[model samples]
Each structure stands twice: as C-alpha cells, then as structure tokens.
Target: ILTTLPRYPIPSDILTKQHVVHVQISKLPTDGVGLQLLELNDDFQFVMSELRQYYDEIKKLKPADEKAKRLHQNETFEGCCCLYAHFSENGMREFRRGIITGQSNGLAMVQDADFPWIGLVELRNLYQIPRHLVGIRQTCVYGVFGGFNMKTENERTLWDGICREMCRPGVRNVATFHRSAERIDYSGRK
Candidate 1:
C-alpha cells in the first residue's frame, strides 16, 4: 500500500497466525505462561476496514508510477516508533515486536484522545498530516509471544507514567520505549 501512498504512518501492532504457531511450537521455554493473541473486536474490525478504504482512495488518486516522487519516510518525527499503514502486516508485527523483542523492551499501548483515525479519506483533505499507523493514536491490541506481558493489573501503568509528561506544556508527542518500558508507573501518575 505504501508504494502507492506517500509517507504513511504505522499505528499499531498485531499478532499473526504464523507468529502464534511459531511461539506455540518453536520458541524456548520461559515463565510457562499461556499465550493469548488479541482478537479483533467489532469496533476495531470496522475501524480497520474504514482505514483500508481511506488508503484505497489514496491509491486511486496517486498512481504507482509516482512512487519515486514520494516523500519515502517510514517512521515518525518523534522517533519513538516507525509509522506505517494501519493495515500492513509488517506494521502490525513492528508494533508487537517493538514491545516484546528486546530482553527488557516493552511498550505500553495507550488510548488516543481525539484520535484522527475516523474518516481517513476525509482526513486526506489535510494532506499535510498523513494517516499512517502512527496516526491511529490509540493502540488497544495485545499479543504475548515470549515475554512482554503487562506486569501490572491494569495495562495503564505506562499510560499513567506518561500522563503528566503528556499534559505538560508543549508536550505534543509522548511515548515510552521498550528499553524504558519498565518505568511505566503502575502507581498512577495523576
């Protein structure tokens, strides 16, 4: 999809069927916790379908021949994560992997406020802001492959930690990386 759309941002990660199978069969032993892949609920599925339609429109407007002229940036200006289409398989894996890949890497998925994901086709009117995966704002999905499980009872630990930082003056983009994943304050920063 990116070959056609320009500067698409990645929004969230997903667990693929193959990944689940690989973990169930090949991955080494850990804490012996059973794995659980997130199921797309009605709302998420609808949002995904709508997002795809928006991208399809972009493909229609921009021809594949124009690929070279595209801006060609696949990451966010914040550098916390790479931006991608919300529908791409690679994007989904990146979201999951960003949190679980490293020995202590883990990212807390947070709900986005005033998320610009709805009506992406219309959003294109604001062409200045491309709706890539990072545009999704809210990431509520989860898939435990090896060991990136949410340590606290509520997954909002990271969200809470970053809440104050987010509300601070002039803090436009706020994110916690996998390396600092453990720093998410389950204690509720508010």
Candidate 2:
C-alpha cells in the first residue's frame, strides 16, 4: 500500500528558457481519455499563404529600413497576439503564430501557438503581421495526452519513460489515435 505519490521533476534542459503556451480545454482531462482533435487544415493553409506574401514585402525593403520596421512592429504588438516567422534548424523558415512575451538585450521571447517551446528570436527576425491575418483563430488545439494515477509504481515508471523519450533532441514523436486504435512512432530529424 502506498502512503503518498512521488512527484517527478520536469527536465530543465528540455524547456530551458521556454514558457508553455496556455490553452483552454472545453472539458477537464479527468472527464475522459483518448479525446480526438480536428485541425482546420484549410484555414491553416490560407494563413501560411498570407504570411508568405507578407515576408516577400519585407524582403523588398532595404536592410536598414527592414530592421527599423520590425523594431517598430515589436513595440506595437502585444504578447501572444500576432504571428511571426520562425526559422527552422535547417535554415528554412516557417510562419508560426506567436506573441512577443518578453524582450531583453535585443532578443524577443516568443511563445509559438503550436509548439511546446518558447523561442528566443532575434529582433530582426520579427515582422509585422497584417491585421486581417491576426484575427484568424488558431488551427490546432493542444491537449494533455495521458492521465496517470501517479501513486502506482508501474504507472509512474511508464510516465517517466515517456517523459525521457520526449525530451530527447532531434526526435519527433507522432501520436495518432483513430477508432480506439493508438499508434506512437518516433523518427529522428536529419
């Protein structure tokens, strides 16, 4: 018999200097399990197209002019209320909806809508999102994946294993559930 449950500490390296984006849940996690999510693919695509056009317009401006424009935009927008272009690890970039949560020493801490991490982006990378695009709702909804009774030793071990795997660098974890069938796969990024 267990007297109390053990609390596991989140790995600091996994989310160092990052802030988790808060999302509203229609129902609490304790209400049920295996909840399915429907993403608005068409709307997401439309927003990406619009962002591309915005980026192109910025590119046309002179380097000094562009820097000034971005600085001005950063000062005007509120935190977590606008979209921004975040460059990927491969040098390619993707437009993610984020808000400037904080700034210091010319770097802005951005909380991306879909990602589980906050990005410390350079001020030059920030751009002004068009007003029309800012009002579009987020396309994806985030959720808690599992509900475990931490008092049980077996469940605690299982949860620990899952956390460790998710913390690994360059490994993308994909979880897909349909009609009660669940699949989880991990693939390494190049």
Return the TM-score for each candidate structure. 0.27, 0.51
lDDT (Cα, tens digit) per residue for candidate 1, span 1-190: 0000111222333211221211111121112211112232343444456555644655566555334323233422222322223322345411110110111112222211112111111111112223343344222311112333456546446544433453455544312212211222213311
**Candidate no. 2 TM-score:** 0.51
Count of clashes, each model = 12, 1
Show where candidate 1 strays beyond 4 Å.
1-40, 63-76, 79-190
- Candidate 1 clashes: the total is 12
Taking the tens digit of each residue's C-alpha lDDT, what string does model 2 give over 56-86?
8777999887776565533534464554667
Candidate models: Cα lDDT each? 0.27, 0.49
| CA shift of 161, model 2, Å | 14
Candidate 1 Cα lDDT to native: 0.27
Q: After superposition, how far is residue 79 of candidate 2 from its true place, in Å?
A: 2.0
Can you give the lDDT of residue 117 in candidate 2?
33
By summed lDDT, the worst window of 10 consecutive residues in model 1 runs over 94-103
